[model samples]
Each structure stands twice: as structure tokens, then as C-alpha cells.
Target: MTLTAFLKDRLVYIMTFLFLAGFAILLFVLENYRYPGLIESGTMVYIAVFAVFLLIIWLAADYVRQRHFYRQLQEATERAGERDGAAIVNNGVTHEQKLVVALLQEQNAAFLNELNQYKRQQELRNHFVLQWVHYMKTPVSVIDMQMQEVLRELPLGEEAQREAAQSIQEEAERMTRGLEQMLHTARLDKFALDLHIRRRPLHEILRSAVNSHKRLCIKHSIFPRIDGEAWVESDEKWITFVLNQLIGNSIKYSKTKPGSKNLQFRIKEQNGGAVTLEVEDEGIGILPHDLPRIFDPFFTGENGRSSGESTGMGLYLAKEVCSRLGHSLTAESVPGKGAVFTLTFKPGGIHVME
Candidate 1:
């Protein structure tokens, strides 16, 4: 908006005006040379002076119109810096300003949307932390109560002592699982740093995951069996964590069934060399409505209401991990029959650390 810059933009107009004045002077001189006093030099000078005066008035007027809009732009930018949030402003005095204003408005809207999304996510995390602390306190309360009883009753019976130890062990394991989940959830935000994608055996991973939940399965009378074998390109640590969540859910829901159930891991190699691992459980299944949003964060439906250990973050994190590593996680369930969570992985080095 400087005067020098504005004059440069109108340089062509100034040049055209000068060229016309020079052409008029040459024509007058040619008339006088052909016939003395045929055209007056003084009249040509007056004409040139009038044209110059008009050019000055026009240039000054144009500079004011443009400078008004630019001055507004500068003021808006300074105000934006002093403010707390995004607010881009422009006075649409020119076509260029109108277009620029529209673009800034679009960017401002997109920034607001992203900011709101982050706020919601942060709120959910804070709520989960509070809920997690409450869940952890339940086990701590039980352990403390059990110890108090033992201390009050001197010469505690060996049978009573054995039961106390068993209860304490189970509570301790529950606390450990909760702690692991919280740690894993915290690490999920920075999964790329911990990712190691390689050729991993699906069967071994399934078996290892089943073994980790053996105690819970045994307690629920659920026998887990892994079938078929296939190798896939994936990150072992994250994949294992996903399987653990799936298997844990299987056993937990199966406990409510009438009899002992079988937790099955059926690995099938589909056409086109892709591998699918299905964790099918014979437990009380998810409702049709809940199945659709099972992977949503903190979305515990009817089933979670009955389960004391349900944090609802488990499936959300599992699905997120699968997506980041270039895989897909899905669920299918019948209300009476148990649910099936299928994790599909492509062959080759198609996985990503993001």
C-alpha cells in the first residue's frame, strides 16, 4: 500500500499519457513547419498541462480506494495477533479483497472444527482417567478389607489364609490389567514411535494372546483354541495388544453363558493373499444397535453395564491401532450368540507406522 508500489502498478497509464503528449507536440510542430503560425505552441502546452493535471487527480483517487482496503487488512492482522483465537477479517471494497476474505473465512472455519475435535478428545481422556481411578479403587478397597479381617482375627486359619491369598491375587491381576490398559492407551497417541512392522506369525501371536488370558478363560470355564496358521506384515507389540483386548472381551462375555464355552481363533487365508483372523466367542452377544458403534470410544452398551471391568476404551484403542498399522477391524454379532471380531491384514510390506 505504499505510494511507490502503487505508482509502479499504474506505470503503464503514466507511460501512455506521456506518449500521447509527445505525439500531440510532434503534430503541432509539423503544422508550424509546413505553415508559420498554423498551430500555436502555447495551446499545445496548455493541452498537455490539463492532461497531466487530470492524470494526477485519477492516480490519487485510485490510490486512496485501494489503500483503504489494505489499511483494513493491516489492522485486522494486528488485532488477530492480540486476540486469543482465530478471526480473519477483510473489508470487501475490491474483487481481490472479496476473494481473499472468502478464503480466510474458509480457513478459519476449518481451524475451529479441528480445535473443537481436539477439545472433545481431551475431555474424553480426562473423564476416562477419573473413571479408571475409580475402578482401581474397587480392587484396592477389597484387598484392604481382606487384610483388615485377617489382622483382627488372630491365628487366621490356613484355609482362610489360602482363600485370602487367592482373592488378593485375583484383585492384583485385575489391577495389573487396568494398569496395562491405561499405559497402552497413553502410548496409543505415539504409536509410530513404538511400531515395528515385520513378518509376524499370526498363529503364534494368537496363541500367545490366548495364553495371556488363560487365567481369565479358566475362571470363566472358557477354553480357547487357535486354528489354522498364516504369516502377516504387522507390528507385533501393537497387534498383540489388540488381540489381548479381543480375547479378554470373549472370556468376560462368555462367563454369563449357561455352560462352559469355547473361544475360537479361526485364521483364514482369503483370495488375493490377504489374511483374516476371526476371534469368535460363544458368549452373550452384542445387541444389533450396539454392534455398529462397538469400536467407538467410551461406548459401553448393554453388555458393558453388567460387566464390572468394562472401560469401553479397549475396543476403541484396538481399532485405532489396527487402522494406523494398515489393517481393518470389524465386528459381527447375533444377540443370543456371541460376537466375532475380525482383524484383516494384507500381505507384503503394506503396513505403516502412522
Candidate 2:
């Protein structure tokens, strides 16, 4: 049934009933009167007119009261809609309505206060963490230089010497990665990760990163290959860092027989000026469950496969860098086969890295 039709019908029935009741009462009073001189014809007419006028005045007052109540309800609804969980109480209200508004106001104030407090605490914590990481770098560098000197002076069988050098290198690299992770995590939310961005050839950055890992690649027998001729517009330093991390992880995880080359870096161009770089490995593949969480901070999944000494932040940092550079990074893996890390970079638009 239509709302208008229902309201019209109900109003008509109610008004008719009210009028009939008023007329019936008037007739009853007139009939009960036995005074021939008490109520003269002129007095009766005056009383009848006064009674009808009084009934009309009462009905008008009742209608106005009901309309005012409905208007107040509508205004309150609109005011509530404009707010964000905040509430206000006007000058006049019943006890229950006042109590509800007061409770909501208290909750809103408490929530705001708590949020402010949390932000302050987090800022202080990040400041301290960043300072600590910076201070520790000097000592870490000193230890690495000292360790290199010690290995240089030691005499041993070829096998023993190689093993010892590898151990020292792994430890030093692990320390460096940890420092980067600590610094990155502390500053992740505060500022953009890109410190320097410019127009640079992808091959130049890739070459530099690979050259830096020459010794490790040679020692592990992981042959790294690069393909594609596309140049990207982004922060060279950060992009290079991301490439190094992915390439390094692939080299570290590959299970090729000792002294066998098993790493590949392939870049391809797609439609719409998009570039794709895939770093594939012949090492231990990530499990299906662990693949999704690989890019998450502090996620070292299913053995320390990502690194010989995984700090669990290389992939996370790389993901963040790619996002800040308007790119996307994804992984595909088959357990016991290998893993492939694909980086999709497009011109113009920052990647939303989490």
C-alpha cells in the first residue's frame, strides 16, 4: 500500500471521529439541562459558540505540537549525519536523550585523545631506533674491516680458506642488511623512500649492482644474465638497491651444484610503455603458503632460504622501493623447482607498496 494513501485514510477517519464525539458531548450537555430561565436562548447560543471555538483551538494546538516534534526529529537526524561519531546536546531534552548524547560525546573525546597519544609515542620510538642504527654502523664497519684483515693473514688448505672467507663475508653482509632493515622500518611511514631520482638507463644500474656481487656470484657459481633495452624514470639509487636485493636473493637461494651458474635476469617491454624485469633462480622454490607473505616485513619463511643469513627484510625493502618508484613486484614459485621475482615498472605513477 502507498504511504500517502494510508496516511490520508487514517487522518480522515480520526478527524471524523473527533468531530462526532465533540458534537455528541455537546448534545448530551444540552439535553441534561432542565432550567428554562437558567439558560436563555441567547445564553445557550453563546455557550454553544464558545464550546465549538474551544474545540477548534485545542485541535490547532495539538497539530502544532505534533508538527514541531516531527521537525525536531528530522533536524536531529541531519545533524547526526554531518558528524563523524561526534555528538552534541542542545539546551532542552528528556533525561534519557541527554544521557545518550553525553555518553557519545565522552567516547569521541576519549578516542581522539588516545589516537594523539599513540602517534606521539610512535614518533619517539622511531627517533630512538634510527639514532641507534646510525650509531651502530661505525662499529659494524670496523668489525668487517678487522675480519677481512684477519682472514688475509690466516694460512689454511684451499677448502678451509674458502670456507672461512665465505663465513666472514656472510656475517658481514648479514650485519649490513640488518642495519638497512632497521633504518628502513623506522622511516617507512615518515617519508618517501626515494632520496634521489633521475633519468638513468636500467642497464647501467643493473651492471653496477651485479658487479658489486661479482665475488659472490663467482663463488656460488650463479651466472646472472640481463636482457631488455628499456630505460626507466625513477630514483636510481633506490631502484638499484631493489635490483641488488632481488638478484642477490636469487643467487643465494639457487641450489645448483657447487660452481654451477643458475641465476638469470631478464627484462622485457610490454604495451603502454611498461617494462618488466624477471630475476629467476634454479634454487629452492618457496612453498605455496609462504609465497604471499614473502614481501612482508620480518617474514623469513620455510627455512632461511632467502639468504644464507637472512635478515628477512631484503624483499620487504625492495617491495617498498619499487612501490615508491611507481612499480610493482611479484613472485612466482614452485617448491623444489625455483622462484621468479618479477618487477613491473611503468612510466608516470607511483607504486602503492605496503
Candidate 3:
């Protein structure tokens, strides 16, 4: 829920009182006698008739007002459920609900704008952090190699020195990876990627990302398999990011069979000219409860596996980038067996821009 949303829910109680007061005043006006001249019986009959007529009008007006307010509340709730950063306007804002909505909407817009600005500022900090991480890598690598040589020359009594040096090297590598992950995650939040869109072979991009991570694949023994080439217009860099995340996730989660790694990358073209990129891994698949939030930014799973040193922004950023570039990302997992991420270049009814 948003700040304005919480405020609006509380405001509903205040609106109830206003409506009730309006009804009370209307009843009072209807009951008041206009003149004091006619016979007593005639005056009594006139008052009864007027009360009955006014009661119907009061009930009808209250019903309409309540219904309209309810609809607006529904719209606000729906808007809060979306994942994007776009402004949400409740459809229930009407003449009757204007003043209340104006207050809530203004509060919402102010908060969202500030939130966006903060994200942009954070992006700059993340960019610097990424550069620092890259710069430090060279020194870290050199130290690690030098330490290995030192360890090889050390005697049995120098075990402590060797262990400490190895630990330092490992820690340095860990910190570097963590910083890189954080930078990527921050980029996801900041929405700060330049998308150079062009028509490209989907298979080409998939293969390139797979080959780049070939070392990891070899270490993990994840096999690569391609089916067909489906042409689609999209940003290559962003698309590469998507592939890295999807395939990386597969490799990370793959369970090693007794003698082989159970991870594979397969791409297939459907009959309707749609390409499906599947990264299937026989590992700890996602739970049913976690599926709904898999694409949410910073959301991992029920376990703490997604957090720790790793920033849980890979899938989140992938979803965002895919949406902006006009593609659909879908996932299906059989718990404990495997998980598959399917990319649909053309979603159900959305036509691509040629």
C-alpha cells in the first residue's frame, strides 16, 4: 500500500459522517412545516405524504453516492497492485468525491515524484560503485595470484598464514561480486538503462550470452542447446542482460546428478513465428506461494536464499526490461524437479511495431 492509499482509507470514515450529516439536514428540511393556517387533519396528512416522498429520494441519493465512492476505492486498490512506477489515478474521482480525491491524489503524486527523484540519485551512486568495483578487481586478482604462490612455498608450520591469505582473497572476490550485483539491482530500481533497439536474431543474442557465461556453464556443467532463430526487434544490451539473468539463475539453481549437471538452455520457435527461450534446470524449483512475487523487484522467495550478498533484482529487472522492449516473460516450475523461463516475443494479443 502507498502513503496516499493509507491516508485515503482513513479518509473514508470522515466521508461517512459528511454523508450522514447531509441526510440529517435533508430530513429536517423535509419535516419542517411551511405554513400554520389549514385544518389539523389536513396538515397531518400533508406531512405524512411529504415524509414518504423525501425518504425515497434520500435513500436513492445515498445509495448512488456510496456506490461511486466504493468504485473509486476499488480503483485505488488496483493501481497500488501494479509493479511499474507510473502514476495511478483512481477512476472513482467524481464531482462528489473531488475534494477528498484531490487531497489524496496530491499527496500521492508528491510522494511518488520524490520517490522517483531519490531513485535517480541512487543510480548515480550505484554507477560510481560499479566503477570502483571494476577498478578494484585488477588489484584483487593480482593479490590472489601472488597469495597462491606464497602458499605453495610455505611450510607446514605456516598453515595459519596460508589460510589467512586465502580467506582474504576469497573475501575480496565476494565483495567484488556483491558490489556488482548491487549495482545491477540499483540500475533496475533507477530505470537507468539505454536501450538501443534494432531488429536482431533472437538466437544470436541467446548464444552470445550463453558463450560469455561459458566458463560458469563449464564449471557447473550446464549444457547449451539451441533450436531455431526467431527475429525480433529489441535492445541488444538490455536483451543480453535478460538472457544473463535467466540463464545465470538456471545455472545457479541446477542440481548436480550423480555424475552430471542437470542444467540446459534450449530455444525453440513455435508455429506462429514466436520464439521460446527455455532455461531448464533440475534444481530446487520455486514454491507455489513464491510464484506470484517472482517478478517483483527485490522479492526472492520464502527462504533467505535470494538475499544475503546477492541482490534479488535479476528477475525483477528482467521483467521490466522485457515489458519496455515488448516481450513477455513466463515461468513454470515443478518443485524439486526443475524450472523453465519462457520468453514470448509476441504476447497473446499484442502486435509488435515493425
Each prediction's TM-score versus the true structure: 0.60, 0.69, 0.54
Give Cα-based local distance difference scores for all models. Answer: 0.81, 0.72, 0.67
lDDT of 3 by residue, 1-354 (tens): 343554465566546655665675556555553433423546556765665567556655655655656655666676765533123444444575666667677777888789899978876787787688778778877876887788788888887897787677666645554554555555654443444567788888888977866655665666767766777767777788788788767766662433355556666767876667777777667889988788987787853264243346778888877886678899999887778888877643133533
Candidate 2: segments with Cα more than 4 A from true spot: 1-99, 151-166, 193-195, 255-259, 296-299, 303-313, 351-354
TM-score of 2: 0.69
Ranking by lDDT: 1, 2, 3
Instruction: Report model 1's TM-score to 2 decimal places.
Output: 0.60
Candidate 3 or 1, higher lDDT:
1
- What are the per-residue Cα lDDT tens digits for candidate 2 across 138-160? 88888778777877777766668
Weakest ten-residue segment in model 2 by summed lDDT = 83-92
lDDT of 1 at 114: 92
Which candidate number has the best lDDT? 1
Q: What's the alpha carbon RMSD for model 3? A: 10.4
Candidate topping TM-score: 2
lDDT for each residue of candidate 1 in 1-354, tens digit (9 for 90 to 100): 678988998899899988988898888889899999887889878988998999999999988877877676667766775532234365667787788878877878887789799978986885687577667777776775676666566464677776666567666666766766786786676667777878889899888888877767777789888889999989888888899889878877888897789988899999988999999999999999898888999999888987776888989999998888888999999887898999998655344333
What RMSD does each model have against the real structure? 10.6, 7.2, 10.4
The deviation in Å at residue 266 for candidate 2 is 1.4
